[model samples]
Target chain A: MTEFEEIKKTLLTIYPFSEEHLKIFTDKLSLKEIKKKDFLLKQNQICNHIAFIIRGSFRLYQKTEQNELTIQFFTEKNWVSDLESLMLKQPSKNYIEANENSKIATISLLDIHNLMEIDSSFSMLNSLIANLTFPTTQISTLKLKSPDKRYEHLLLNNPDWINRFPQMQIASYLGITPETLSRVRARIN
Target chain B: MTEFEEIKKTLLTIYPFSEEHLKIFTDKLSLKEIKKKDFLLKQNQICNHIAFIIRGSFRLYQKTEQNELTIQFFTEKNWVSDLESLMLKQPSKNYIEANENSKIATISLLDIHNLMEIDSSFSMLNSLIANLTFPTTQISTLKLKSPDKRYEHLLLNNPDWINRFPQMQIASYLGITPETLSRVRARIN
Candidate 1:
């Protein structure tokens, strides 16, 4: 099956969708390629589109007055959208940037509203958004609630992330400083 | 309209649901009464149900070795469920208790899954969980990232919360100490 077909299959696997329902989504979406370091989105810009990464890597981050913090990372077969800014139709305080040259498909919020109105199955799609976003934040929140356990768990679960991301970025994502992370790593080893 | 009707309306407003969909939820749910300081859910027990508070307040917390930390709180018209424990169907690490004498409606996870299968509109219901849980942690994480701004923003946005929640709980939720919150409040006032 093609990437488009995969998109429908992947989405429908998580949500129950019919052919007509899938067609509504495919019709409203456009496939695009983004180069490494190219932005899929930026801070202070309005996030009107929600993009699903078909392949490649992207990181969503926020720039606060003190420093930049990595909120989340997205890779192949994952959806990355600033839901707060996108749903509210406000300027995003977050930036989503490609980490590697990437290809993604995106659908506008207006199209989503239209699809939800036209197709009943799209209601399940809304749940898909909730479920997808919930776990992403849940994992981070779980980690933040208990940084020591989280650091140990992360090493056990996804050591690759340690090697893939910069220490400072990972530190920010973990809600800790680079020095703390380094100390934790050293003690664990 | 009845309280159930209000709930059904809220559900449909976010994602349209049919009569059959609404019936499925009401059929499986039952209203429950909880007294102030009563345990709606307890640590180390399997979280078998999700409760929606129709009246009164509730709090979910975890006990660390040194202190008990408030993970979340819910007022009237809010839902409370241990997402991680509920989804995993494991012994919960947190406890959800009534802050004030409360009346709640609850449904079992099994029943919810049945509802999900029977009608897709329930998916949006799952997404709404974050509406209650995220703000606390999100504010805390923001405070961790940019303490001054988030503190100022919180004071500006919900000045009443300072008076509503205990100082220690507010400080813990903000990932700060009571002394620090006192200092911060002083500076703000």
Candidate 2:
């Protein structure tokens, strides 16, 4: 399937928009390519577009004075955006980076307004914020689990993330030291 | 204005809907009252309704083996519900309780469906989750501040909650001990 085809399929799966509506949406979308280790958004910049993943993946992180913290990951068939920045029109405190060579279907805030103008009940767009909060569930993980349990929870939820991403990224996401992550893996094994 | 009038007024302020639409939505809402310490929802129970506070306030809490942590607070004119439990139909890990004698205008999930049926663009009903996530901004408080700074934030953002709630509840919400909270207050004074 084409990259556009994957985006259309994914949008349909989430919101069940009709083919006509998907055409209205996809027509406004432009596909963007990013190489590995490049950013879709840098810290303190306004996020200009929302994307539906067609190839590879992306990771969002927050850089504090102490360290860079991984906030979330998005792979093919997922919608990716800095929702707080997009909604509030503020520079985001987070960074969004392409995890590998990636193709993404992108839409600006204006495209979103156009779509909402088209369908008052236009819901797939609403579902994007709901999807964004799943990673905010990470905040709960930090609250609700010990470090070891958090590692186990990450693997159980997204084993593909573990297998595909570098160890350092996963360790940062799990909010543990690389040494601690290695020790946990050894214990689990 | 009556409590119901305030609810109607607040609803219009957030999402402008005609009287006809407001009647369709509000006709389904029943005003319910609760006394201090009674639960709107209990841990492991599904949150079956969303409410707009008519009078008094509420607190959402999480109980572990060692602690009962206050996750959020809601006051008059605020909306309250466990959005995760309401949206996903999962049993919630948190409890919502009245902090004082309280009146609330409430709609069941069935009422929400009825409203959505009336208008496919039925966004006010859709907005309850977005409203719920606003308080989940408390999660950011944990990440962004030390205990003292968190206490300062509580005062800055919600002076009414600090003035109305007991010091213990405020301490719990700030993730600090009562003695520590007292010390912080004394130092400030």
Interface RMSD values, listed in order for every candidate: 5.7, 4.3
| Clashing residue pairs in candidate 1 (N, C-alpha, C atoms within 3 angstroms) | none
B20-74: candidate 1 lDDT, tens digit per residue: 7787777777898999889988889998687777888877787777876776667
Over the stretch A21-129, how does candidate 1's per-residue lDDT look in tens digits?
7877888888899999899888789987877788888887887678777777777777788766665456877788888899999888667756655654565555445
lDDT of 2 by residue, B17-56 (tens): 7888877777888888889989999989998798888888
Complex DockQ, candidate 1 = 0.18
| Top TM-score hit | 2
Whole-model Cα lDDT of every candidate shown, in order: 0.71, 0.76
Q: Candidate 1 chain B: worst 10 consecutive residues by lDDT?
A: B131-140
Residue runs of model 1 more than 4 Å from their true location after superposition: A5-9, A16-28, A44-48, A88-90, A117-119, A135-150, A179-189, B1-32, B40-54, B63-67, B77-94, B104-130, B136-154, B177-189
lDDT of 1: 0.71
Model 1 native-contact share: 0.04
